[model samples]
Target chain A: MDLAILGAGAVGRSVADLADDYGHRVVALADSTHAAVAEEGIEADAALGRKEAGDPLGSHEPEAVFDAPYDALVEATPTTLGDAEPGFSHVERALADDRHVVLANKGPVAERYDELRELEAASAGSVRFEATVGGAIPVLSTIEDCTPESVTAVRGVLNGTANFILTRMAAEGLDYDHVLAEAQDLGVAEADPTFDVDGTDAALKFVILANVLGGGGFSLADATVDGIQDVPGSALELASEDGRTIRLIGEATREGVRVGPRLVPENGALAVTGTRNIVQIETREAGSLHNSGRGAGGPETATAVLADVGRLD
Target chain B: MDLAILGAGAVGRSVADLADDYGHRVVALADSTHAAVAEEGIEADAALGRKEAGDPLGSHEPEAVFDAPYDALVEATPTTLGDAEPGFSHVERALADDRHVVLANKGPVAERYDELRELEAASAGSVRFEATVGGAIPVLSTIEDCTPESVTAVRGVLNGTANFILTRMAAEGLDYDHVLAEAQDLGVAEADPTFDVDGTDAALKFVILANVLGGGGFSLADATVDGIQDVPGSALELASEDGRTIRLIGEATREGVRVGPRLVPENGALAVTGTRNIVQIETREAGSLHNSGRGAGGPETATAVLADVGRLD
Candidate 1:
């Protein structure tokens, strides 16, 4: 497969670096402004080195990547809300060109799914976003294999930042601010951790899950979300006493999506510690299936994008 | 797809009972001795009712199912080791007839995987055994989606009986024998609990996983097996004291398969309670992915078999 990766972030660069290992070639690599396009294959190291040195990846503009001959366009740009612009437009441009799309960006899938599906239906290409939910844990693909109709619901701890804070607070008997600061210090939580800590990130993932289950007609605005911002140390201590712990869990069914700090069994599968994330998929026939792992990371998310790419044709 | 189910067990009967719900037809149903065949569709309830009443499922001989018109042969018979007979021959017959095979039986998949693959390679039909490893958990399909080549290792607690016993022992400070007896009384463990408690059952499942990961060449004999029978209640107490618990954990890599009582964090994903099962798939690029759910049940396993049938073009 020939990949045109749009974004020079960790996931995009990793995809460029490892595409060859997966028997794929990167034909185009782009950031916000500059792009490096090669018919055979891009000099990935040089482009990435230039990216590291704070210069243009190549002489071409980012839009030039669309002209490159590529089998799939990997959308790894930073996610945006509502209109899901740039990412949504990138997908629109890819599908318009009859090129398959593999998304590492969550915005289009979460906030503009029906439009995305409409675009997919009109185009010869298909859109896949396994990286948009649960990182490389294969949540969407698992639901796909079981057929989304048979899946009753999906629930889990999807935000590693919030989960890290909650897990640390419970283990160390610290308050939210203290743990959040500690997580920031460890680089586990972003400098601006609004989305991760405020439930928008997890909600977006669950909204995507809801769309997959219900088949379009879902977006972030429909979800009911509650973050762990106010979950105090005493709350964790109380939950611990009751053999439970509070996790910022998200649940998505066909009818709705909800993300909140919920109590889960302390020694149960849902109370995963540290930066780990777990997704519990409830099926009509198979009961509940829980998939857990690192739900965030450049390489981890890149593997999911490549896996989605592998699925296309 | 028209199904010819060759077993009157819980899984087979449930497959027949629910085939209509999944938009499929059961044209033939059989046990070890009797068969029911109808080109249109069999009265599944009648055949199952007869079996429940301590009578033959049908009037025809079991071999007659082979002559029935069906798209797939569902092997839901009891799992047997060594030659994996009857089931192995049945699968061979189906593949020879260019009919897809969905297996609930672990024998052919775990012990005779090479022969099964050889038969599949020569025939137009494809063999899928999703129910063989994790019952309804979608373990094999997840690995298939991830591409087994990229999956480095698979680890988890696979046997429900063993897990139930271990959980009760830890919770109630009960000995292995007491828990085993309780499990048998509760119908969680079979009358002959040797396989479940001695790790033979979990080993069979892991051997099947190894075959999937390595593309054949594994059996129960290739695995290092240890059961929970010798794991005293004192061991559970000690593990609990350290915020850990003993589980009948199995790990399957391309190199080998191992199943034994191992300590996992008390609140870890692997410490699933009661009769639940979990599988941790370690991918080279994606890190570890854990899937937990009901490992065994009639309807649950039937869902997996039907899901496999759904995948057969």
Candidate 2:
């Protein structure tokens, strides 16, 4: 299948790697500065070389995406100024041309499920964004198939960066700032990781999930979010004393949703250590199905996109 | 869809109840001694009442199943002695006629994935058994979709009877006999719960999951099985002191497989407390993804079966 990936950053390269592995031809890759088209598909290793050399592969337009036919468009761009900035138009253009969209880009999906739904209806196109929410967890696909049962509750650590920092604080006795600094140095968190640390990243992902599970476009305004920034250092110690751990839990239930750093009893399945992320989706039928692994990172998100591609062909 | 439930056992009723809720017409029921068929559909509630009141749904006959023109057949009878058992022939007969089979009965599928696979190919039928293992955690469905990715490892607490016993043994420092008594009393363990406690139950489920994930059947003998009966009470205390819990982890890796108890660190996702059963499927793409929840009983398994039906439809 011919594919075009928007954004040649970490997520874009990751998708490119999976596409190359699966032997799918990537037709286009667009970054902030330029768009590159390669009918034969860009190699993942070569793309990595370009990134290391301070020049990304999508820095020049190759013109193949415009001329060559493609089946799907994988959106991997970063979130712009507000949420619906340039990425929205990139997705709109692709969807308008009847391309099936598999999104790892959060900005377009997080803000415009409604607009995209309309585009999908207009063109009778398919849009799968399993990577938009739960990395490789398969939460969206399950919810999509199990509709009307209604996933009444969903709770988990949605952001790997905040989870990494919190896990470090609880396990290694590192303070918030110390752990945050360590995370930044290790490239686990952004230089300004406010979206992850303050729970906005998780909240956006949660909104997308809620929409799928609840059977509609649930806006950010409809959900409640709480960040880990206010969690006191002493709370971690107190949890440790009581054989517990403090993990940032983003929970949405029928009896009102809640997102915060929860003092979980250590015996729970989600009491994961290190950088592992866990998501639990509770439906009327499956009760609570808890899934845990990597919640974020370019490679993990790319793996999810590849999973989507696998399901496609 | 017109459905025929071929047993009045716990599994049969579970499937019937859920299928009825989804508005599927369950037209027939068969037990070892009797069979009931109805055009308007055998009401699940009425059948349950008959079973509770000491009536056997009425005298099994060979022609009863053949007479019904149902869309799907739910085989829920006990495992017959071998391949020539009544349930096996019954399932084969149903599939021979092109009926989709949602098997809640392990006896048939455990002994015959290939036979059933052939039958499915011959008749172009669909076979789903989400309740066969881990109630409705969607293990089979998850593994089915995980075909493109190489499943490196399949590990988790597969037996609720063993897990419940182990949890009691780990948390309260109880002996095997004492925990067994508690599990039986609470309906967590059967009167003849030897299959579950001795790890054979988990072994069969492990083989089934391996088959779906890897596209080939794995023998029960291929797995190194160990039961919870040998775990001493003092071992739990010793492990707990170091912040750990003992769980009967059924694991299958590409190199080899082992189905036995493991002393997991307290922070391990598989170190689930209470009667909750957790399974971790390690794939080439998604690194160990852990799913945990209630693994046994009527309601939970029923929920999963219903979800599968919903997805399949």
Candidate 3:
């Protein structure tokens, strides 16, 4: 497969770097301002190195990628909320050209699924965004394999930042503020962790899941979300006394999506620690199935995007 | 799709009973001695009702199902080891006639995957055995989606009976024998639970997984097996003091397959309790993925078989 990757961030760069290993060629690579477009394969390592050295990927304008010979357009731009501008528009252009779009971006998928699916219906191209939720966990594919309606619910600790904070709070018996600061110091939490700590991040993933399960009628606003911002160490201590611990759990049934700090059995599958993420899928006949893994990382997220490309092939 | 389901046990009955809901017709349903064959689709409920009443399913002989018109043959017959007899021959017959085979039996898959694949390669029909591993957890599909080469290993508590006994021993601080007796009383373990307790059951599943991941050269003999019989309650207590517990864990990699009692983090995802089964697929890029659910049950296993049938469609 030939690939045209948009965005020169960690995930996009990883996708380009690893595309060859997955038996694909990078026809075009871009990072907003400039693009390295070639009918033949582009040198991913050279382009990435140039970007790392604070230079243009190539002399070509970023728009040149649309004309480049490619089979799939990888959407790895930063996630944006509400209108989900650039990502949605990028997807639009890719599908309009009859090229498959594999997304590592959550914005277009979570916020604009209905419009995106509508656009896809009119185009020869199809859209797949396995990396949107739970990073590389293959959550969406599992539901797809089970057939969407057969799976009744998807619930999990999706936000690595919130989970890290909660897990540390429970393990160290430290207050949320202390752990959040430590997490920030360790690069586990961003300096301004509002989106993650306030449940918006996890809510976005679950909302996307609800969209898939309910067939594209959901967004972040449809969710009832609560994060780990106010979960005190005392609550963890209390739950611990009863052989339970509080984790920021996100659940998405067709009816609704919810994310909040809930008490789970201490030794239960849902109570995963550290930055690990897990999703529990409840099926009518299969009971509950769980998929846990690294929810976010460059190479990890790229594997999901590549997997999507493979499926398109 | 029209299905011919052999073995009128729980899984077979559930498949026939639920095929209509899945938009499939059951053309033939059979037990060892009785058969109900109808090209226009059998009355599942009526056939099952007759089965429950200890009467023949119909006047037709079991061999008559082989002549029935069907899209797929669901092999739910009892699993036999070594040559994996009737089950293997049943699958052989299905594929020989160019009919797809969705298996609930583990014998052929775990013991004769190479020969089975060879048969599939030469036949128009294909073979799928998701129910042979972790029941309805979608373990096989997850590996397939990730591409087996990308999955490094598969490891988990794949057996429900062993897990139930171990969980009981830990929770009640009772000896293995005591827990086993109680489990038998509660019907969690069979009266002759040797297959489960001695790790043969879990080993079969892991061997099948190894076959899938490694491309078909494994059997029960290749696995290094161990069980929970020697795991005393004192050991569980000791592990609990260190925030750990023992579970009968099975792991399958390209290199080998192993099933043994091992210590896992008490609150880890692998330490799922009760009869719930979880399989962790270690991938090259996705990190560790876990799928947990009712690994055994009529409707649950039936869902997997039916899902495979849907895939064939």
Q: List the residue pairs that clash in candidate 1.
A: none
Residue-level lDDT tens digits of model 3 in B1-313: 9999999998998999888878899999999998999999998889889878988898799989999998899999988999999999999998999989999999999999999999999889989898888888878887876779889998999899999999988998999898899989998899999999999999999999999898989999999999888887889999999999999999999998999999998877788889999988888877887778889999989988888887774
How large is the C-alpha RMSD of every model relative to the true structure?
2.3, 3.3, 2.3
Candidate 1, residue A195: lDDT? 98
Q: At residue B68, what lDDT does model 3 achieve?
A: 98
As for TM-score, the candidate ahead, 1 or 2, is 1
Residue B290 of model 3, lDDT score: 77
The alpha-carbon lDDT assigned to residue A258 of candidate 1 equals 95
lDDT of 1: 0.91
Give lDDT per model, in order. 0.91, 0.73, 0.90
Candidate 2, B13-127: lDDT as tens digits: 7767777667678888777666778877876677677878998664546359557878888777774423626767877887788777777666666666677777778885577
True contacts kept of 2: 0.55
Top DockQ hit: 1
Candidate 3 per-residue lDDT, tens place, A136-242, comes to: 78788878767788889998899999999988888888998999999999999988999999999999999999999999899887889887888879999999999
Q: What is the TM-score of model 1 when looking only at chain B?
A: 0.99
If you assessed candidate 3 against the hidden native complex, which CAPRI class would it receive?
medium
Give a tens-digit lDDT track for model 1, residues A93-203. Answer: 999999999999999999999999999999999999999998878798778766788899998999999999999999999889988899999999999999999999999
